[model samples]
Target: MNKLPPEALEHVANYFRTLSEPTRLRVLNVLGTSELSVGEIAQLVDSSVANVSRHLAQMAQHGLVARESRGNSVYYRVADPTVNELCDLVCGSVARRFDQVVSAHAAFVASTAPARRRRAG
Candidate 1:
């Protein structure tokens, strides 16, 4: 892949920074493909309405989410579909890493088991 310009790299960094917050990630997961009001998102994430609203505002500003008003309430949905793909990629990588660690630990324990038995006897 070609190297990105400094300004482009900065924008990329900013976008990642926007998704860095755990609450925002939870908000995105709860949102999925559904457009939900602040209260709905708050309920799903088990957070206060005010807190959810603030996070939504920040996400909206970053173009990570879009807002629409329907009668009395504003509903939000993911504006960048690629964000889901990005999250999935990271999650898969993490899961694979965890599996490797577990497998390695099991192998280590198995390898040492016979040595321990030999020493005991």
Candidate 2:
């Protein structure tokens, strides 16, 4: 198997590190839809503005997102459209897996439980 060069490996590692947090993922999800101000994203994600701003800053530094200032508001959006696609793909897969797990658990429970007779009038 081929291995990544040191610089490429470092870049990939940093990218994964940046995406390792829940808040960062949430921010990316929200930004994937459309551009929004920091306050708006914070509200949607139920995070403090300061915390959201910090996450945004980190993402912007990593080139995962881009920000533009309009008067007093700063709007942020996904830097690359592929990012939204990637997030959607991963999240959809997770949702499908969770659904399968729940279905299997329910089936197991139903099969193990004894059938109860209906009460006579």
Candidate 3:
């Protein structure tokens, strides 16, 4: 099999590293829907303003998101629509896995539940 060039591998690794944090993933998820200010993002993600700002800055540095300053607030958006696509891919996979688990659990519960007799009204 052909291996990725070292530089390409490094770039891919860096991108994955940026998304390795749950907070960063949450930030990306929020930004995927609409642009939001740091304060709004922090509140939505249950993170501190300082921490959100730091994460946004790191994401911007990696070209994962773009920021625009309006008045005193900085609003961030996904740098590329492809990033949103990647987010969707990850989220879809997770949702499918969760659905499978829930279905399996439901089947097990149904089998284990006591049968009930029908009563005439």
Candidate 4:
């Protein structure tokens, strides 16, 4: 990225922007496991089929995922394996941070509980 030209940097930014949507992220999570039809994805994501189809189209346009046509139905799957790796890294980082936050909150509550109890007694 540091060596990328201005236009290349812009393109990279746009790529990240495409992954920034919640609905798209949810769709990706589903695709991470197995390829699924738009209706199946919509059911899992609790969205309408039309809405899921729109999300898939946007992601497919960005080459983040690919779709297969079977008869009249389409099944989407992760196209770029690197996207899965990127997602794994990001998700792992977030999960670790969340665990740290939860632990810190628990410790703070535990430390304060004794003080509050002492003050009451």
Which lDDT values do the candidates have, in the order given?
A: 0.94, 0.89, 0.89, 0.92
lDDT of 4 by residue, 23-113 (tens): 9999988878588999999999999999999988889888999999999989999999899899999999999999999999999999899
lDDT score, candidate 1: 0.94
Give the number of the best model, judged by lDDT.
1
On TM-score, the candidate that comes out on top is: 4
Runs of candidate 1 with Cα error greater than 4 angstroms are 117-121
- Candidate 1, residues 71-95, lDDT tens digits: the string is 9999999999999999999999999
- Candidate 2: segments with Cα more than 4 A from true spot: 115-121
Worst 10 residues of 2 by lDDT: 112-121
My TM-score estimates for the predictions, one after another, are 0.90, 0.82, 0.77, 0.91
Mark the regions of model 3 whose C-alpha exceeds 4 Å error after superposition.
1-3, 108-121
* Cα misplacement distance, residue 87 of candidate 3 (Å): 1.2
Question: Number of clashing pairs, model 3?
Answer: 0
Tell me the lDDT of model 4 at 40. Answer: 93
In terms of lDDT, the poorest run of 10 residues in model 3 is 112-121
